[model samples]
Target: MIIINVLDNFQAALEAPRVLSLNSSKYFSGPYGEDIVFIANDWHTALLPCYLKSIYKSRGIYKNAKVAFCIHNIAYQGRHAFADFDLLNLPDEFRSSFDFIDGYTKPVKGRKINWMKAGILESDRVFTVSPHYAEELVSGEDRGVELDNIIRSTGITGIVNGMDNREWSPQTDRYIDVHYDATTVTEAKSLLKEALQAEVGLPVDRSIPLIGFIGRLEEQKGSDILVEAIVKFIDEDVQIIVLGTGKKIMEKQIEELEVTYPGKAIGVAKFNGPLAHKIIAGADFIVIPSRFEPCGLVQLHAMPYGTVPIVSSTGGLVDTVKEGYTGFHAGAFNVECETVDPDDVDKLATTVKRAIKTYGTQAMKEIIQNCMAQDFSWKGPAKLWEKALLSLEVAGNEPGIDGEEIAPLAKENVATP
Candidate 1:
């Protein structure tokens, strides 16, 4: 039903540019359906490329349009029973596009319809979030989630995602109580730290190293290992703050931290956008121990605020962080294991202790300046996206349809359908 709804709305969007205005003597003055390039992101919209190829293009409408499929995370590919293929309402000839036979030892055996596979097969271009993640997906079955071969054959590109510097910037963020750039970071962060400590019910001390963990508390985000690492530091002077909600077990564990080690730890198991800004602004270090990250945004958010990240070296975490310079590597997690490794917990705790040792040193100040100076804005990534999209133009066709110069469409022109 979602596929059908998306297809119907897509067809409507295709016809929108041709709609005649009843008040004026002109139609919508923009590129028509044939000039558009659709981008389908992840599994929810993965079927768009397949439908465009097998339905719209087959009917001679949107003949020149192309689809680029973006894989944010390959783990959650839309898989359903082969019998449910009929719900798609596609022709019998396209059935082969959705067919899959699982050969792995995992459960859910026999044939299934994999939407992400079809998207990769049908789309003109395929890409993931970060270059490292792109390589990880194609490296082996461990990171690929059973789609590595298809990803390798399709040839994935990686464009690291960008952060909204305006919103996340320390100098201009409206959410934060105080503002600071590299020059004033020390004094400003001290003030913000005191304020945040008071707000979260922790002891208001600016001298102690205040560490933060902000993300979904799940296995992927390494919440279990974070808890274990906190246990190792229960007797230490460092203070830790965690912001996010996930599995009830993880939430309970986080809440337990405050009770187990009063004045040293606090966890808020709910989403609070304003507090998030305050935490990033106030904390000395941000922890992102993701087991497998696909171009994490939290680390990017931390960098501009001079909050050094202590992250697991996997996927985009490896791409963005420079050890001992911008942040510390908490060591990589075992990708093949179903549960957290004790060694990973020890590594994270050791790294946190190392960071605490470096807290007020001259070297730590230099690291803060380096972190603040690093740029993760969208300007560079946007150009790469434009170049990638332009390369998808059909060989024989001119850049524009019917001699009209093909101006880049604004965000409003891109249809979510």
Candidate 2:
């Protein structure tokens, strides 16, 4: 349970005159146990050096520690300025290890290091959030841009991410007006649909399928494509409810769409977790037309609420949503494509229409049932992660920090650097 809060003031740390203000001296004294998990760039980039220093300090204590570096997304690999490398205070021998050059394509840049790449190179095991995404990275889909070659050689595994089932359960969720599961979800859904429509000031109609979009308003999430499709189908018999805010231009466009379609469309420009749960419980279909996704958790959260997800056929969306079974999928856009086009819109609209037509039909009910039957809970993934860690070979005779030797991490033991 120990949560190290390192450099609480990020801006202050950045503006500090000296590098030692990061307090590596105090944090490096701690001992490394049998396992260490490097999360995304924020923590991994900042704490990696401290962890490395600590490992070097406690060489006797952690001779055979296993490290796992989890890549949530490789698109935004931590690429700080070359001058900032001095802040890491790494020794001369290891300094060049972090030094990276952009040479996969044309015109090699001088001395730019990717922290994510460094983590991948350093870790005992590497993993991403989904199997398909892991494949994509190694396949050079996105130019193999960041460390695809290294990743392929080093072996990166994919373990689909899971959600907190208890928090997303439709039968137990407190955010929704009514609680129901697969068996009684139909009636509950109808009631919640009307409630949601009235709450958002839509026409309170159950016949028209209410399509909900609750993610970032960015091209990567295919917000542009979604907005285009909705605008194209403004006159169609459906309601659009957007529950997220990003990209000022897209937000403005969404608000404009809301105004143009008055009661039929509404864009609540913010991230409200409870509202998201309510939207999931109330909407007939949740749309996630991401251009690229490592492993999306929103669709997983939506499924337990008996909400059918209409996703782009890529990454975890493909792994989770079975066509016409749990839900439906549209086009699978590749990295070579500059932008999502009308063809993508056609695919999206076709599935949306299918979902609408199937409303109240036996097929729709079965689909909802199938979605609810799915187990996207974290239990399986936790076991898989544990198995991955245990598979690693221990090299030293030094005493391992198993349950018998070391106490569990507690809040009291959290070191503040």
Candidate 3:
């Protein structure tokens, strides 16, 4: 049987075999020679998942059991895409731990994916965070490689994400004024709404509905379309509260809108988790205007707070947020629409207006109730991994597997890149 380890270092999955860190295999294609799979996410900060999956395959690790990961943003190739952070200013505790790679600049290339590809190919399985994304990465070829073929050789799983209790709990929250849980959903909602409005300097008029738009302000995040839509809708009864900073033009427009529609539009150019949670609790609806979401955590945060979501139908949003249940679908194919443009100003505004109307119905209430009841925990997913590891068939390496029989995977035997 093959044993697997799940590293909690956020980028442990992305840095499978350590992409940013220098490696013996960085310049060479692998015949990895050992079995070890790393479950990586965070594509923006590291290599595309399959490259590493393939890296493991080439190494002959998968001859016994394939190595895999839960990938997010697997195919995103946008400009200035990598996360920009002060790596040098990392905390004293973190600094001492990562002394090996002080000048890490970039990850391995996707086209030269053999090293990563070999790992995945040799692996017993590869699990993705979103079923749709698993289907996407496993279906098409982009530049030089065929993603479909790469995925075919490895078993890909679509494991939906669960929130960390340490971070998302409302019981001991420091951000919200009131701390409550699923049982006190009603009281929590009301309190959060009032507190959020007051914090944002908006009126506490119980009659008006507030719309919460939070997250990074980028096209994938759906802020560009939202700016255009809000311009057209421009309603007095509906207030829009936005948290995050991106796109200078969008920020300026949001600022202008707040002035133009005093007490209606509030924009915060920063990420405050407690504030974000309160905003979710207080709002009538939450909008996850993502173009391609691979299991969004925000949609998860909103449902339990009784805030309906207005999202595009894609990735985890499809699995988690129901079309007409926990939230309404914006239904615009913002991406890959060559013939008909995704929603223009008029259509975007119309959709928001329609969703707002439906949000007030008893039917909407039932949908939220259903969403809250669903399980969003890691216990179930951990069990699935346990089963795969337990049942995995193995053998020692042979000439067929590169030389001697492929050895059964043990934690001590799993090698690094």
Q: Rate the local accuracy (lDDT) of all candidates.
A: 0.82, 0.71, 0.57
Sliding window of 10 residues with minimal summed lDDT for model 1 = 408-417
Better of 2 and 3 by TM-score: 2
Clashing pairs in 1: none
* Candidate 2 residue pairs in clash (backbone atoms < 3 Å): 1-409
TM-score of each: 0.88, 0.81, 0.67
lDDT, candidate 1, 321-384, per-residue tens: 9999999998778774467798888998888888888999999998899999898987667767
Q: Which candidate order results from sorting by lDDT in descending order?
A: 1, 2, 3
**C-alpha RMSD in Å of predicted model 1 compared with the true structure:** 5.3
State the lDDT of candidate 2 residue by residue for 1-417, as single tens digits. 112343344323322322323334432433333334323232245435334444343565344444567777777676655565666545545555567777443223466756676677766778888888888779873634557887897898888987766667888776877998777988899999999999888998888888888888877788778877776665768898887777898888777766888988898877676777778889998989787888898899889888999899887888888998999888686443356677887777776777777877899899999999999976677677666766775542232222221223332210000
Instruction: Report the number of the highest-lDDT candidate.
Output: 1
- In model 3, the runs with Cα more than 4 Å from the true position are 1-37, 42-66, 76-124, 138-149, 152-155, 181-184, 247-249, 336-348, 389-391, 394-417
Per-residue error at 361 for model 2, in Å?
1.7
* CA error at residue 81 for candidate 2, angstroms: 2.6
Pick the TM-score winner.
1
